[model samples]
Target: MNLKDLPIDAQPREKLLARGPAALCDTELLAILLRTGTAGRGVLQMAGELLGKFKGIAGLLHASADDLKGFKGLGGSAKRAELIAVIELARRALAEQLKERTVFSSPDAVKDFLQLHLANRSHEVFAALFLDSQHRLIEMKELFRGTLTQTSVYPREVVKHALAVDAASVVLSHNHPSGSVLPSRADEAVTQTLKAALALIDVRVLDHVIVTQGASLSMAEKGLI
Candidate 1:
């Protein structure tokens, strides 16, 4: 049945307005974005079909524009743009929150920020959090992207960037797209090499965080630093 045929409380739009977005199911949320469905299908039905086809919200969000355009209900360029915009907004919001707060002082904040930025990625990424002498955030820079298992990190380049920014210390981070937060032998060796290089310029290496979708590991906490 169409949404209009359902009881007011049973409708996704009505329920959303009455309660909150957090209360809505994934299908309902997608229905709102889709707005309407084809001639015989209700918005909710279309949403369910789309979710099934994409294997869920994460798959849909990460889908390429061409992939989305191939889908019946999501073929329009406007719809594709809207979905991409929402994802970008979410990433930017997390980044902005990290910038506005004390990044290093709170371990939870750092984990949450890094998780939001790196967890959902499909490949490896190496990033740095440059902090002032007080441990306040100076800047967050994404230095490299690599294959599923490894990335080539140059300690000399990292030191150069730290000096350019006058960073007193830094939190090094990289994601394992394989979803394992355990630091490999190579990860440990590179962290040590970067630490030694940065120390030459008196820029302390505070921590090396290994990020995955499910968890993050701190090298300092593990006594690896």
Candidate 2:
């Protein structure tokens, strides 16, 4: 049956309008984005199939443009483009939120922002958040990207960049493509090296956060710093 043929309250769009977006489940929300259906399936049914095939919303969001283009209902260029655009907009909106707030006052916000930015990535990425004396964010930089198991992180270069940015403090972060939030021995060694090197220049190392697909771990919170 057509989505419009359903009872008004049973419709995803109507339910969303009646109860707001937060009231809709992931499938319902996704169906709205998909907008239409195949010959015998409704938009909601197609959305559900896509979610199941991709392993839910995270998997779908993490899928590459080429990968999405190969999906059944998403094979069309216009739908694939729409999906990619929506994902990028979400990332940009999250970044804008971070820019408007002070990192020091909201440590949780930093964790949330980093998780959203890096959690779905298939490869590892190392990033730094530079802060001024007042702990306001000065800059956020991605210093390196690497394979699943390792990324070459340089203490000297991190120090150089910190000095160039004149950052008073820094928060370090990297994603584990393996979906494990546990920091490896190399992760610990690199954190300590960077901390010590940054200290020589009177810059403080606040935290080193290891992000995974589902969660993040803070070294400072673990007393590793």
Candidate 3:
């Protein structure tokens, strides 16, 4: 059924205006952004299917343009562009918040930021979040790629970039494409190695976070950092 067929109060736009965005379900919220549906599928159904296809909003956060292509309601450039833009805006907003406050103050935001940047990759990516003395974000850099191992992620290169950014501390991150957020033995070793190397330069290793498509694990919280 089309959105117009729904009761006025039940429509996503009208519901949001009357009761606020939080009153809407995920499908309703997404339908607002999608605006319209394909020939047979209603906008609400399409949004729900899209969420299911991507495994919910977190999975959608990192979807690339190519991923949207050939999708039913997203065949046109406008819908695809809107989705991509919204996702990017979410990322940038999180980044701005990190820059404005001590990262630890909102630890979940740090994880969310890293997840958005690191998760959903087909290969391993090792990255760092350089922080100022106050632990505000300086920058996030992808320092190495391929399988994450102690040998593959060079401490020298990480140290170099940390120095270049003049980071007083760093939060290390990497993605496990296998959908498990558990750190491997190599992950722990690399974290310790990078921690010791950064310590020599007076840079603290705040944490090492492991991210997958829908979840994250913080080594620091687990006392591994």
Candidate 4:
């Protein structure tokens, strides 16, 4: 069950060096991060257990330090810190990409940026990606929390933030903790309401994205926007 017990080429580090990182499965890659395991659990076993507990890599990466507490191999601060740091780095990398290029040029990146920010929440969150005239990201703000009914999300507030950021266009985003990225009637109604309100100020609503832990849906792509 130990790394040494495996054939050298079968070990995580050995396999990574032999065939590159893409060749390693999630467990092997995570085992390398973990380094070692508890007295009884091997690193691969511990890694598998962690992934299972969290539901997979995306769930694990988004896990908070407190969420990792009491886990066998992750009881130490170092491993937990590494995991948290990785996710933060990914978010910053995506943010940097959005800052450097037009969002429309790579729509998947925008969805990824929103997914990393909005996914894994236990409740609904209504957020906006305020963009510059060239459609590059200016800021992403979480404007409303709790249920995302039209009543709960105020278009006036969204318009105010858009003006404050000097955004010429905006992408609306929200998370469905229920794991369904399907936009409900409320989602459509609020998008239209915000679209109308922003139009009054000469701001454009570019897209409305619904995100969950593992998937995302773009209203613009669906012609719902």
Which candidate wins on TM-score? 3
What CA RMSD would candidate 1 show?
Answer: 3.0
TM-score of each: 0.81, 0.87, 0.96, 0.94
Where is the poorest 10-residue window by lDDT in model 3? 67-76
Instruction: Point out where model 1 deviates above 4 Å.
Output: 1-5, 39-41, 49-67, 147-151
lDDT of 1 by residue, 1-225 (tens): 677777999888899999999989999998887777878888899899988886677556556678778888677778779877886776677666666766665788788767767766788889999988878777888888885222488777788899999999999988888978899988888888888899999999999998876589999999999
Candidate 3, residue 99: how far the Cα is off, in Å: 0.2
Q: How much lDDT does each candidate structure score?
A: 0.82, 0.83, 0.92, 0.91
Most lDDT-accurate candidate = 3
RMSD of 4: 1.4
TM-score of 4: 0.94
Q: Where does model 4 exceed 4 Å of error? A: 1-5
If both were scored by TM-score, which would come out higher, candidate 1 or candidate 4?
Answer: 4
Tell me the lDDT of model 3 at 98.
Answer: 98
Q: How many backbone collisions does model 4 have? A: 0
Question: Considering TM-score, where higher is better, how would the candidates rank from best to worst?
Answer: 3, 4, 2, 1
Candidate 3 vs 4: which has more lDDT: 3
lDDT tens string, model 4, 35-148? 888888888999999999988988876688889986867777898888888889999999999999999999999988888888887788899999999999999999999998
